[model samples]
Target chain A: MIVAERKPFDEIKNMVSGYKKVLTVGCGTCVAVCLAGGSKEVETLNAELNLAFGKDKIEFGAETVERQCDMEFLAELDAKADEYDALISMACGAGIQFLAERFPNKPVFPAVNTSFIGVNLDVGWYEEKCRACGTCVLGLTGGICPVTLCAKSLFNGPCGGTNQKSCEIDKDQPCAWYKIHERLAGQDRLGQIIEISPPNDWSNQKPRKVIQPGYEERVKALGR
Target chain B: MKSGSNLEKILKAGHFAFTGEVGPPRGANVEALREKVSYLKGNVDMANITDNQTAMVRMSSWAASIICMQEGVEPNFQMVCRDRNRLAMQADILGAYAHGIRNMLCLSGDHQQFGDHPQSKGVFDLDSMQLIGMVKKMRDEGKFLGGADIDGPPELFIGAAANPFAEPFEWRVHRLAKKVAAGADFVQTQCVFNMERIRAWVAQANDMGLTDKVAILPGITPMKSVGMAKYMKNKVPGMDVPDEIIKRLQGVDKKNVADEGIKIACEQIEEFKEMKGVAGVHLMAIEWEHKVPEIAERAGVLPRPEV
Candidate 1:
């Protein structure tokens, strides 16, 4: 679901201008799935860089690790750090930070812009969804996420911009407000749009520096 | 044949030249293919004999090229490297040379997964670029891909595929340049329906100096039906099936889709004839080989060059 885009070649070239030996590392996770920073893209980038700055001008290296997010993956690179002058990470923003943390001395440049977590509409196409605001509002909005659709992410009521059951911003697509109205209308509770709800508490949901636990905790406890 | 030989003659022959492709018939059945070539004798300048097209098991390209030559049709042998290793590829180059298949089109064959034999392991020991380089090495240095000396190399008029509408269009142009650098004499692109995209590609090719060195033949295929057009747009990679073409097909009566398809294809061919950097058109009708002459005639691509 993670969406990313490759940085332009000119910028990438400038980043590795002084480096004699460069390792272009690819992540086989979200970046790979989005086709931005996959193994093939890494190899192509390597070939292009070589072709641009003659093969003799740069001592280039390339590899793809399992996942740049995990410490285990970073540990695998311990044996080959000396062979590279700098590292270019083709992973999300978080994965790049993790790599930078692991290899403090080496300069690490991001090869992709971490766009958003979303769904692929077609092959090689993706649309943004779920801003990851550290809160879940699906219970009131139904399974169809209004957070990504709403012009203002207003959980309280339907916005005034809903025209002819379509969003004013994009007329081709349905309005989130119209959907909430329909849901309320279906349940014989048409007045739900007018129902006042308290504003979302921003103080209690401050961004934290650490992700305490993910899916691994359940697996570790089960020992499967 | 000397330097700048077969292709130079072919390119100069110019407009209205007809060509047809023969996907070598599988198993001990050369009769059908030979007959197809014979039918094309008075109509076409060359018969593009394919090498195991669609990843289907078939007669070798060199074998088919030799058969076509014997049948009085100049064969533009299509050679793919999906099934062969570097050794086999190099060996085949020499073998095709011995059999007199000078007009060679290099292809990275269809994946085995798409074919009936999905279990068969694909040996992509070298991609299209590597194969082009290997051929150039053999022809220019009189040596195999392995740096070993050869007695003499075949004089190959090399052609490679250019997929303009492939994802990341810039990369396709880069790939075409790489093929050119690898000594590709000409290019035959994937079926082009979107003329705007083709025009852009032609511009990029011109920018890359490919126009001067390589003759680019944009591949064209007629839309048989609305369903077939939809299927192709959805399934075929490197194919640009524009909306107008779809609407054009949809406007036709159900029974007349084939004729409509031919009309559209002929229009594209005619338009492409005047396009800059476009040397010719490579018509791929799949199984509908008979319509090629009609399409060519309609497109005003007439009078096959004197053989």
Candidate 2:
């Protein structure tokens, strides 16, 4: 559920200008679900690029390889490496880095801005939920990820900053703390608010790097 | 077959030629259009009547085509998919044909956001290619898009649009090929201000053998003024108007730009006539339909191709 916004077409066009043979690689998992790096989007971008600059100016190609993190899916692009001068990735920052790692010499550019992951409110609209903070606070926050909702990421109960159950930044939006209070009241555990959370640990950053073991076996088995 | 309609004869003839379009005014007034039809009746072989062009609410292309048909003018009814589905499209095509609106142009219209009704829901159940395929299926198989068999298949002379000047010139030829394969009898391209680009597109089309398969009618729109030309270039989708043409229009006197526009259109038609694959020209004077005949005559299309 990684949320992302598309980069403007003009900016993307300029990024791949140097390369005559370009492969637009999209991530089928997260980015696709978010409507960023899907098959349809890749097709549209391909068309846009072909229209702006003739196909001769840029021999553009498009393919949505599976999860960019999975080395197996990433290997699918290896066959096309010789055909492209560069790869334009339509995935999150982490996925783009993975692609860059896979094809060291070939340059990679991102066509989408990797925003926070969440659910779509409706068609062409999205709402942010998880921030992917390694430290789990759901146990204390009554299953609500306060890190994503709270502007201050307060682990404890209602902050004094709340004005009449509304967030300070946007008065119309109900304060995350106030909503947490309502949830706690319903659970008969308002006392849990007084239990202070420990100082946030910075070591959670190391877990961000996803490593898959026995990757070569999987790559060959998958026949990528 | 002795109905011998002008549109029928044109389709039967091998030479693909140019055409021009005019959107009828909003209201019911008919005098201005009458004047235009009277002037263009014999001058230009056919004129396209636009249907709620740009998704903007306006007088129907169907009704206007009916008027022009009665005036002895051949009309290509421009049908857009923004407001209708296969049902409406099929019904409209049948109705237009019944009313002698023989030539039909298929288009996936401009989105509602660009039009007056930004809040209006768009019905894109079928795109231009699907519409082309549907019409083709109807003609070839005697079956409607719904698979319901008709007593007799429609003998429609279908046309679709290709934007060679549409940004991404590489896919222009490919998209046109799809249209032809889908069943477009001919293509009325986006406006052509830059002949070099048009030549490139035509060359691509020829290389793909698409030029031999479908009639390619290059489009020419008379520039109202330098301002209008600039507006069109900046605003219109798939419409590419060169800077030199704008510069030429700018150099002319503003009051006489209409005449200059007609002159430019005539010049374009004359230039297109020399090209090998060009079937004809599609003139889009928009509201200025009266000038088409004069432009055609000036471009040497007036003796009109032998029927």
Candidate 3:
């Protein structure tokens, strides 16, 4: 899932400093699951902000939607748009962007730092798993990602910084290429690690948008 | 005759090669660089001009390499993928080639967190392996990475770094083979303090016939003090400075520690020459460039080949 973390309280406070009435919108999907921008978090932030700014003549409200990325769920804020001077979006970058598109006139601010697409390792611990590099070589790498996991993102093999099964950059982190090597060796596929991968095709540049033709055709045929 | 570099000529002639490093000045001043290169002119075959090494901003390696050429020494231009995109890298390659830089060392640079500007974004559009392959493609195919035709591709003697002390130690030689496959003409390793580990890695490389494919120059850094030795062992990533070496350094008086370091470096170089498949010793004197001549003389790599 798309992971995110709350921005510092000072930065969040500064973003809506002058706004008299502020609305904090939270996403209930990824951010909620990560315990970052869920309904409970939104309420806690709202109460904190109100307590901090009450003497400064400011009011705050909190609400959460099913998924901030979808326009359908975001439409729930339209009726309350006129009640607040500004809005704080506690969601991933994509959700924040979509929220801004929904409320063109209202001042929309992101209250979180969109980290990466990762899985929860444990409670409050997340590790990045994918880079969405358009090309996936997991089949050859034995289900490990050298692209996102290796500090150097080396395709052919690990850099000289791997030490005792950990990365040389940070000893706490496991070396991705080492893990891939172990995985491939376990499967008796060590030969795969030596094959030279061609230069990465970066044609799928950033801010990328995709359209599923089959889904689009189905929607069009349904005439909905 | 790739790049017609002296280093390449010496290695091609089957003579033991000796390369030295010259870090560009932190500022734009070239006098300090010239002074450092002076010590290396007759003592080494080629000098590696570092590119923002350790992520600290310095004069571009391209410029420093040209300065080396001006000082009558061949330069191995070091490039890291941390600071530039493909367009910038290609442009610099053409510029460096035009300015007479024949050799290039491709590296995945140190992470920015270690540098002065930790807040900066790293532009690793290509990893070191990909960069090596890209440079080879440009030179051999006479085409850019995007397959665009170049009027004249940069002819370079490609070099890459290796670290024998890094973990999954058994895989080091295989990684070196991969680099050679990616188009490295030669390989220079991280500083060697653990000779046993390096000897094992070299033996593996010999068994795999990798030593025959690419020239391998093991890195040697003279320990300036016991503190420096401890720092390398504890702080420097991928460096394996054995505890015995640190203890040896501790045995020396503070004033004689630098000499002890040089003595150890000389011993490593001598042993490196006898190792099968070893090409040369890359003496990285760091800031003590003045001591390179003495180190080279003591190690018997002096009177460097003129080829």
Candidate 4:
């Protein structure tokens, strides 16, 4: 899931300082699940901004939708959001960009910083899980993503800095390769990791587009 | 004549080799570098010039290595994957070779987080294993990683760092073999203090017949004092310092603790000499270069073997 962190109160407050009526928008998906841009968080930020602005200096409204990245959910606030002087999005980067796109006349501001694609290790804690590098070698590495876990993202094996099952970076951080080797050794699949890996393919054609296969077929059939 | 380096010739002759290291000064203090280089000139077979050791910036290893050459000491230029990308590394390899450097040690550098500038970005476009393979490609096949044929390829002896004492003790040997597979012609293990653990690590490495495949030189960093010993035992990652040695250093007079540390380092080298598959010792007197000559003499590896 995409993880995000809320921008500083001062920064958010300063962004909507000139706007008389500002709506703090929230997304119900990744940012909401991460507790940064949920409806309740939006309410808290709305009240904080109102109080910080003091007595009628600015009017603030809080609203949340299923997901801002999706156009359908964004349609709910498409017309309603434009009435405000500005819109502040408390979603990931994509959501904030989409919100700005949906309400072109109103200024759109981000209230949260999108962190990473990660998993919740526990409540209130998240760790990065993938790099979306377009190449996946998880099967070859015994279920571990050396690309994400290893500090250097080394695929061959652990560097000499792997210490006592921990990384040279820090003792608390377990070396990713150690875990890979352990998992592979247990499965008698160590040979998989022993093989050399060529350099990763990072074909950097930016802002890449991928149309889902079935959806592409449907669109082709419609010929719209 | 892979590299035609003095270190390579000694190892090729089946003679026990001795190598020492020198960390370049933080700035352009050539006098400081030369002083350390002079201390190690005739002491060891070749001096390993470190690149940003401990993640701190220093004189460039290739530049310092060229200086070592001017000072009459052959340099085993160490390149870490932390600081540069493939283009810069390959470019530097050609440049270093042009300056008469024949030896190169590949390492996945210490993380930038542990450096003077923690906020600085790290450019690990290639890890150490890949770096080794890439260098070998340049040397053996006369081809760049981008698969372009080179005008004049660098003839080099590839070196890599091995940490037998790190973790998953059973797998460390296999890890060394993996390095060997990556085209490492030789290697220097992480610093050793616990002889028994490294012995076990080497035993496993020998069982896999890795000793014959590559020259294995275990690193030896002598403790400077009781505090240094304790700090290494507790703070330094991938370093194994036994408590007994710490106790031994502590048992000495405060001034002579360094001597005791040197004695202990000598003792470790003594053990390494008797161990099978161990081809050499990389004495990392870190900042204590002056002590290397004395330590080498006392360790019974003196009258440095002439290849």
Which model scores highest in lDDT?
3
Off by over 4 Å in 2: A1-224, B1-8, B253-256
Q: TM-scores of the models, in the given order?
A: 0.57, 0.58, 0.95, 0.95
Query: Which one wins on DockQ?
Result: 4
| Candidate 1, residue B195: how far the Cα is off, in Å | 0.9
Rank all candidate structures by their TM-score, best first, as comma-separated numbers.
4, 3, 2, 1
- The candidates' DockQ values read 0.01, 0.01, 0.63, 0.68
lDDT, candidate 1, residue A183? 70
lDDT of 4 by residue, B117-141 (tens): 9998787888888899999999999
Which digits, one per residue and each the tens of the lDDT, describe model 3 over residues B253-303? 889998999999989988888888999889899999998889888999879
**Tens-digit lDDT string for candidate 3 (A1-224):** 99999999989998999989888999999999998999989998888888878845788888999999999999998999789889999999999999999999999999999999999999889989998888898998999998799876767777666677888678898989889989898899989878888767765586675658668887778686
Ranking of all candidate structures by their lDDT, best first: 3, 4, 2, 1
The weakest ten consecutive residues by lDDT in model 4 chain B span B165-174
Instruction: For model 1, state the Cα shift of residue B233 in Å.
Output: 1.0
Chain A TM-score for candidate 2 is 0.87
lDDT of 1 by residue, B173-272 (tens): 6557666777788788777888888898899988888887788888878877898889877655335688888998899889998999999888888887
Model 1, CA-based lDDT: 0.74
CAPRI-style docking class of model 3 based on DockQ: medium
User: What lDDT does the true structure give each of the candidates?
Assistant: 0.74, 0.75, 0.89, 0.89
